[model samples]
Target: MAGVGLMVLLLTGCGTLQRGVDMARGAVFGPKGVRPAPEEVAASPYAQLLIEDDAVSAVMLLGNDDDGRTAWFTDQHVVFLCEGDLVCGTHGLSARLDDMRIVGPNPFVDLRAIGQAPFTVDRRYDWHDGYRYGVQVTGTVRRVGEEEVEILERKRTLVRYEEQLSGGVDGKNIYWIDPATGQLRKSRQLVAPGHYAEIEILKPYRRRVQ
Candidate 1:
């Protein structure tokens, strides 16, 4: 009951908009650093559509033994694709065709994509999923194929309330996004007792009309 009460107080006593702005700027540019205005970052292409939301799909061409494939709907529908029957008409159809379909709405948003800079880091607002609280903008530079790429990270907190209802959770979420395409490359969650989950982007694609 004590812990619950504390959570309620923290939520109700969150800092004002100015504080949020200061935190965002500090995280994005570090101390004594100047960054592009929040509006500019929010308006950048990096803030544009990261992936198809209304419809989604992808194929994972794993090695011979594990040739993989997938597809799903963005709205409220979910369907898993089978690898068989995918090559039915080709000469190697029998070898590559695996037809299967399981239903479930697509999972949560692409974490990496959600961490785009300016939108998450430099922006002057919070990104919530109606359940979790997300903040902190992280960017990393890495080598990709012969070129250096910059990636953004989004940190979120997941919540689960008891009978008190307004209590928040204590956890951390990290999202890795590719700035070049604004696609989510990976996502991670860390909770006390050291429980964590990671989702990696192996393949991605836009919806294709049949």
Candidate 2:
């Protein structure tokens, strides 16, 4: 986690965490001009996050949530709250998914057991646009079968799912889940209409038994 300290320092030197992350995009990570190797990513427990292609490295905050939610932060400012690899809330994005509630069965919780294809789950969400809050939407998720994908040079098969939302927001939430670990390797989720987030879990967060 030595690199994490340097990343934090860069963010602290800059004004806001958001701005620091933006500046560090070119200054901190640009020297490489390419993605790091798999071994380097696996060396530290960090996840790579991207909101609309702008990339940033995130540190997972240790938690003991009974519901299995994990928190991730970038420069200790921007936050991404996840219910088992599925994003439930976000902060510091231009537009954000303020809150999300899975109404019935949480399909994301069980990647390996969703039987055949075309399964469904009910969900609701609170969104934050450039405007104000109180924006609510509901949606249904559908299983989209397994897909072969490569991440940082490693190839694997991942189960796919999508959320088609309506009633206030109109967009789709997509995910690629690793059946073995039940972790989302990649996801493209709609934060708000015209705004979405893409996250790649370069290195997954595993809590060290303390």
Candidate 3:
């Protein structure tokens, strides 16, 4: 929030009619820092659409796997396509990624089933940067152990996992998954070379077991 406030101070001096409203509220803070609650996400009397800083709306979930991958849009129609907690592809980002294919078995989708075991998964995606498009990236996924993380004055023990990605992009992808429900709580993934997306799932959608 301090960063945004400092930016507001600097940008406010510039003078533009629309710039006043362009400053963000719920958009700036880091995961370990101050973040909004679940209810603050949807300000409208209608759907969940309205985060103070940006034109951020509630999660606009798409259909099944083929139709969509749990997507949402923000800041000038920027869409993020997510498979569980991992961000697979993106639109409206500086360097775009498309056609993300997770080759073979993906155990990271459910840690409860896999039990935090070290695993490997390969992925292919189109890179808009110099790497070009449709290149493959190899990864070794493993549990880095558990730690206590505090969010909004609440503390929870979360298992931290790191994925060392090689080939197309060389970087580490980190994820925090809830062991009991086998759901992703938050993650930082590289959508393109040198470009990473820090995602925090304020509220996760889970299917009810009948």
Q: Which candidate leads in lDDT?
A: 2
Error of 2 at 7 (Å): 14
TM-score of each: 0.24, 0.67, 0.68
Candidate 3 lDDT for residue 109: 60
Preferred candidate (TM-score higher): 1 or 3: 3
Report RMSD for candidate 3: 9.9
Model 1 steric clash pairs: 78-104, 83-98, 84-97, 84-98, 84-99, 85-97, 85-98, 112-176, 113-184
Summarize candidate 3's per-residue lDDT along 34-107 as a digit string, tens digits: 46565554442212211111222323222123232544332233333445555665554455676577878877
What is the lDDT for 32 in model 2?
18
How high is the CA lDDT of each candidate model? 0.25, 0.58, 0.55
Query: Would you list the rank order by TM-score, best first?
Result: 3, 2, 1
Q: RMSD to native for every prediction?
A: 23.7, 6.9, 9.9
Q: Report the alpha-carbon TM-score of model 3 versus the true structure.
A: 0.68
**Model 2 residue 193 lDDT score:** 71
| Model 3 misplaced regions, further than 4 Å | 1-34, 38-68, 207-210
Q: List the residue pairs that clash in candidate 2.
A: none
Summarize candidate 2's per-residue lDDT along 31-131 as a digit string, tens digits. Answer: 21255576765664334443333343333332223234544454333444456566676655556676676666777766556666555656666764554
Off by over 4 Å in 1: 1-167, 190-194
